[model samples]
Target: MSKKLLATGLAVLTLGSAPMALSHLVKDEAMQSYRQSYFTLIAMNFGPMTAMVKGDMPWDDAKMLALAEDFAAVASVDVARAFGPGSDKGTTRAKPEIWENTEDFLEKYAALQTASKGLLAAAQSGDRAAIGGAIKETGGACKACHDEYKAKDYLY
Candidate 1:
């Protein structure tokens, strides 16, 4: 092949892959902020329901269902790409084991998703007792992951 032609071919190959590489880099850069925002949203949805379940707030079935639905919607988001390599950096409580022990992290994520569904179902049923039980179960699922995958004093 001509030297000029060979150079052109190599340039084409490098440029062709640049977008994919850039995309991955962007994802990694955004992961920590995105993950933090996502969890904040989840907490926003969870807080009121927890208060209601604990009798600190008056029970409102409509509000309960709406919050549960919101929680479920957030839970359903595909976060598979949100925990990419180096995502444990910055202002995150995420443990390094999340990437090292990926399977366990994924399992915990799945359990949280399942619990969200159960909470949604219980909320839709309009039974305060059922919703309370579901909340407890869901809280357990959250704690299970938090205990192992989150660092204490991480927020500070």
Candidate 2:
């Protein structure tokens, strides 16, 4: 090949490889953040759910409802703040595909947030039917995200 042709080929190869390399590095950080966010949000949300279920909170149904709402509000904040377009080596429990397919990840998160809000609304109404529906929706959202984004080892 002519020197010019070789140069052009090399340039093309570099351009293609660069993005892959960058994405690989980013995928690690993204995975790490996913694991951290998962653990954090679960800790925050389950506290109130358990409290309300056990009647441990010194609050009325209305107060429990408020706490549920508070929990949902923090859900989105935690994911948004913790995850990014990159992955980290430290995140073994998280899958790198989340950052790789960010749109889907964000969509799943939005669904979870919406369902969590529904749960809070139902808790506020003190209606058993509504609460059941909302809880199911929230569980669906959690399962959907976990099935797609989380590692199985973390689950078991």
- Candidate achieving the largest TM-score: 1
Task: Give the 10-residue window scoring lowest on summed lDDT in candidate 2.
Answer: 84-93
Tens digit of per-residue lDDT, candidate 1, span 41-111: 88999999999999999989899999999999999996757898766776678888788888998999899
Cα lDDT tens digits for candidate 2, 11-53: 9999989976555344536645455655566657656665555
* Clashing pairs for predicted structure model 2, backbone only: 26-86, 26-87, 27-87, 28-87, 28-88, 29-86, 29-87, 29-88, 30-86, 30-87
Query: Which residue ranges in model 2 land beyond 4 Å of their true spot?
Result: 1-38, 47-63, 154-156
| TM-scores vs. true structure, each candidate | 0.79, 0.61
Estimate the lDDT of model 2.
Answer: 0.68
